[model samples]
Structure formats: C-alpha cells, structure tokens
Target: MANIIKKIKRKHKKKKLQAERAKMEQSRQNRTPEDAYQERLSKHRSAVIRRAVMTVVAVAAVATLFFFYMEKRSYHNYKILSASEQEDVVATNYAEMSGKILRYSPDGASLVSDTMDTYWSTLYEMQNPVADVRDDRAVIADQDGTLLEMFDKDGETGSVTTSYNIIKARVSSSGMVAAILDGGDATWINFYGSDGTLIAENQTHLADPGYPLDVAVSDSGDIMMVAYQFVDGSETTSYVAFYNFGDVGQSEDDRIVSGYTYDGVVIPQIMYLDGNRSAAIRDDGFTLYKGSQIPKEVETIKVDKEIVSTFYDDNIIGLVFKNGDKDKPYTMRGYSTDGSLKFEKKFNIPYTTIKASGGNILLYNSSQISVMNSRGVEKYSGTVDGTISDFIKTGWNRYLLVLDNGVDVIKLS
Candidate 1:
C-alpha cells in the first residue's frame, strides 16, 4: 500500500511542474514582442513630427525675407518722387562721365551730348547711379594719338589710325566710320568693322584748308567739312563741302557751296542738328541751312554783350552772351525757328549753354545752375561749389551736370 501511494504523488508533482513551465513561456513571448513594437512606433512618430516642424520653420523664414526685400525696394523708388519740389518726375545722373545722353534708337547708336568730356576717364568711372545709364558708345581720342571706340554693351569694339595731324575727328552716324582731319590740311575718312578691320578709306580735299573749324557726318554716313577762307586780306569767307565715302560721282550734288561766300566772314561753328536741319554760328549771327545746301535767312540775335555761343534746338535757336562789359553777368536769348523773337532772360552770372531736357532749359552760370521751364521761368536753382563746365540732358527729366571737380546728378523735380 505505501509503494502505490508514493508513485501517485510523484506523477501528480511532475504534471504540476510542466503546467507552470508552459505558462511562463507564453507570458515571456507575449511581453517581449509587444514592448519592442510599442517602443518602435513611438520612435517613428517622434521623427515624423521633427521633420514637419523643421519644414514649416524654413518656409516661414523665406517668406519673411522676401516680403521685407520687396517693401524696401518699393520705398526706395518712392523716395525719389517725394523729394521733388515741382512735382515733376526727374532723374538725377541721367548720364555718367563716360556715359552720354543718346537719342533713343532701336537700331544704331550715337554720341548725343552738349560737349565732349575726356572720354578716356569717363568710360571707366561709371557708377550704379541712374544718371550713368546710356546706350551710345564712346569714341576716345587719347593724348597718345590712340582712337578707341567703346560700345555700351561691348567694350572697345573698334579703333582707327590716329590722325597724325588730327585737327578734328568725328564718328559717322552709324558709328562705323571715323573721319579725321589732319593738321597738314589733309582729310581722310576710314570705315572700320566692329572688330577693328579696315573696310574703306576715302581721301578728299577740303574747300578751304586754311581754317577748318567744324566737321560733320550726315545720317547716311556722308562726311562734310566747313572751312573758312580769306577773300581779301581784310575779310573772311565760309565754304561747305560733302563727300559720299566712296560713292563719289554718283550724283551731281557732290559738293554744294562749291562757289564762294557772299560776305567775307568765317563760320565759328557748324552742326547738323537733325536730318533736314543745319546750323552755323558765325562772328556776326547764327545762320541755318535747310537740307544741306539751301541757305535760310540769317537770324541775327541782339546780344547785350559779346556773343560767346549760339545753339540750335529742335525748333529754336539760342544765343548766349556775356551780359555786360564786366564779363560776369550773362544772358540767354531764344529765337523762333524763322528767326523771330521768342524770349530772353538775363542772369547775374556768365551763362554756359546746356542741353535742354524734358522741355526745360538748364543753364550753368559759373558755380550756380538755374533750371527753367520752356517759357524761361526759373523753377529750381541750386549753387554748385565747383566750377561748372559741361552738362547733358539725359532725357526730358534728368541731366548730368559736370564741374571741374566732380559731377552732380540734377533731376527735374
């Protein structure tokens, strides 16, 4: 009986121990995998939130910068308008020392300005100011007898042989040919490629070699010279001639004024202001020639003092003179297209002729400049500390005022 009892107890104990082992294994498997999966899910969610936050921050920063930048630029342009007293929109520094005011051309380029500034230095000292913007090229005649042609887009596009006797050098309207009159009274016009290749050269004789004061090129690239001659030992005569590059005998109109001058007077300066209009200032008064040779009536403007210069506008001509014997005061008198009296103004300072911009007249009298309306009313006046020499109209609204010391951008406001 005792042996049977021991066997039953041992079997019962083995079954209980097996049941405990199975339960522990099931719990172990469930706990390990569930905890690991939960931890992995938490880590993935944290990484996704981090990426989304960073993206939003970066986008916000870019938007802020862009908005401020645009606002700043808008304020800048508006500031230019608020500073004008007359409420006229004028741009100061329309041209730079090297940059010149040019008529708007969609095809070709030309240097259109009041006078020449030492082109060598002007071409290099361009700033980002609005005044220095131009489309014309610079034709530089250096002291070393180097003729360089620089385009607004291309630097140093062409050059020509420096005139050995270089009395006056001028570029054609197309900016392709350079006509030079040598000191030996020899004149040669050479056409060059934009790459500095010699294309053609035409040598011609001037009407009067003794006094060659002005040279001009028509819009068609025709070269002409205005020379002076002495009829008798006492009086002077003026003559004008033309050369059509190489198309010499194509027409009977090779040279007009091939005759002689009625009055023995020399022309001080000459200019072809536009296609059909021409003007010359002589010792006596200003004269206009219509269509190259047809002489118009001489417009003699009365100057209060010695007449220093006469300039031609599109429809009017102006004569500037010293006001009195003192040579300090000056007056600018305007004339109609038909030599009729337009209007005149007397200034306290000696006046220098400046180009008209935006239908307004700009005059520099010594160290002071006066801006006038088309009717000769003084709109705004400013005092320039330096001696003013030259000025150019950038357009109808702006000008580049140049002095011996520096340049000022004067806008019509």
Candidate 2:
C-alpha cells in the first residue's frame, strides 16, 4: 500500500509532538495565583540573595579578622585587678574625675573611687597645689595662693578667693574661672564666677598685651585663651588672644574676638580643642583656631626638633622628640587640631609622664609603663607598681594606678 502510507505518516508526526508537550506541561502545572506567587517570589528572592551574600561575606570575614587581631596584638603584662585600700598616696596629686580619683594636696581636695571610694573631701589651703580637670568639672588651684576650689563629680561646687596672687587657675566645664592675676607690674586676667563672682577683668601689660604666658578655658563656660610673652626690642614676642564671653563677644573690646602675633615664637600653650578647635602650643609650631564664635587662624605647624614632651587630650596633640635614634629614644608626634598629621611614633619610653587619653598613648615613668594607640599600635609594654602617680584610663585596658602604693586597678594582660 505505499509502505503502509509511509509508516502512518511517521506515526502521525510523533503524535503531534507528544501533543504539544502535554500542552506545555499543562501550562506548567496550571500555576496561576499570580503564577504561583511569581514562582514563590522568584524562589524567595533567590534565598534572600543567598543569605545576603553569605552575610556580607561573614561580616567581612569577621571584620578582617578583627583588624588583624588588633594589628598584631601586643601587651606584655599587668594584672592587679583591684587593690584599693592601703592609703597614703604620698605627695598625693592624681587627677581624672569622671572616672573618679582626684586626690589633691597642698592640704586637701578629694574625689575618689575606682575601688578607692571617698567621693568628696574638700578642705583647702593650697599654697602650691594645682589641678584642672574640665569635663566633670574640677579646679583645685592656688599656685601663688589666692585660693580656688571647685569640684563636680558630686561635691564642693564652688569656692574662690582672689585679689591678686594666683598666677594660674583655669576651670570650665561649667564651673567657670580663668584667673592669672599677679598685678605686680600689671598682669591681671581674672574672670571668675563659680561663686566668688567677678566675671571679667583684664589688665595685661609688659608694655601692651603681653605677659600671660598660658591660660586656657573653654569647655563652654564661654571662650578664653591667652598666651602672651612680650619683649619686642631685643626680639621675643608671642601672641594669641581670644575672649568671647558669649553674646558673640559683646561688641568686641575686652571680649576681644581674635588675635595672632608671633614675632619670636614662645606661645607657651593654649588649648580648647574637642571640636570647634583652638590650640596654640608653640615654640616652633602649633596654632590652630577655627571658630565657634570668632576663632579664626586655622593652622600653623612648624616643629623640627626639641619638643621633649607635650601629650594632650581633647583628642590628641602629643609631640615628644629627641630620637637621635639611640634605639628609638623617643619621637612621638601626633597632631590633629587642624594641623593634621596623626602619628609618627618611635618610642623607647623613658617617659616621665605623658598622656593622650582615650585613644591611648600613655608613656609613664614612676616605674615604667608604655602604651600606644593613636594607630601607631604598641598597646602596652608593661612594668608598673607604686610611684606611678597617675595612669587613669579606668576601663578598656583598665587602669587607675595612681600609686605611691595605693590604687592599682589594672588589667592589660
């Protein structure tokens, strides 16, 4: 018959392509509740994008393995976890309120606890005592004696008695006072008011706007910074003044708005930088001043050598040099109040006392203790016990060592 009609016309075209692939798999199993919820929301968005790319690559591989194990960890030793109770901190002077422990001397001043307890012990006579805390307020003065005592970690909030003869007194975290009076050849700066009120007075002169040498107050008790030192004819001038008792500097005269002059360097140190800048510390370099109300100057770094030691806090401004490299005999340089440069580091630690606070960099010496952390790493080299005088970080690597045999509270292991 024609070969059986060519095998039934090739089996009727293979049963019409298996009946159109079973009607396209029955229209894909008849799905249509919005296509089975858009195929289960596209397989639940591909399993939540594969668990968010495996949880962002496992939290960036555990933050790059905890930043290379805190940049190659280092902490030699230390473990006095607590030991406050033996008394007699010798010439007693520690300072670091807000983390407790103030302990002054020229007769009295106290605010302790970091295991040492005793949060208030006022009694002043201070012939040469000196302190200046800032954030939780603290100002135990009396350099040449005219009295001053203000505390605030909960106790003794005010007391001042001036009439000239307190060549230095600065406190402002709300217990305002900015004294520097000793008007013998005219040089009174007075600005008190923590309850001995006298808000403003200026009578400086070494032949016009000079001799203030160092005075800084600005923790929002409303601006002030002076660093004079004058002697023009044989050269040796220094300047830096800015006073603004808030009100945008009441029409500008004694509330002087801005200033800057440095014919021969000598800026003795002027600070107020925790953000809205104001620093001056010079003798070759350091001058930042950026407004919160007429601050201006901005930047001035010069330094070449001979810094010896400076250490600050308001978030760093260190500076210590003398590294003729006798095995890294010291060269710590760190800056940030606008002059940039954050770390140079090269320590050997013979430090007599250095501190930078919070970002670390505490090189001590009353029995050695070197730490480093403004990203120069070197977190602790250890050796501590007694005579430490003050290391007070209080938490992280823990420390409150102010000793002469008293409060230990360490933990740098």
Number of the predicted model whose lDDT against the real structure is largest: 2
Query: Which ranges in model 1 have alpha carbons more than 4 Å from their true place?
Result: 1-138, 143-157, 176-178, 183-209, 223-225, 245-262, 292-305, 323-329, 336-338, 352-359, 385-390, 402-407
Cα lDDT tens digits, model 2, 1-413, are 99999999999999999999999899988877999899899999999999999999999999999988976788788888778656666756777666677788888887877676786787877768889887788888888878888778877877877777888888877778788989697989988776667789889889788789788877777888888888989999997888999899999888888888889788787878753677887877687888777888867888878887786777678788786888878777787766778778686777788877666877788887877777668878767655776786855677777767677778787
Worst 10 residues of 2 by lDDT: 84-93
| Residue 58's lDDT in candidate 1 | 92
How far residue 286's Cα lies from its native spot in candidate 1, in Å, is 1.7
What is each predicted model's overall lDDT from 0 to 1?
0.51, 0.80
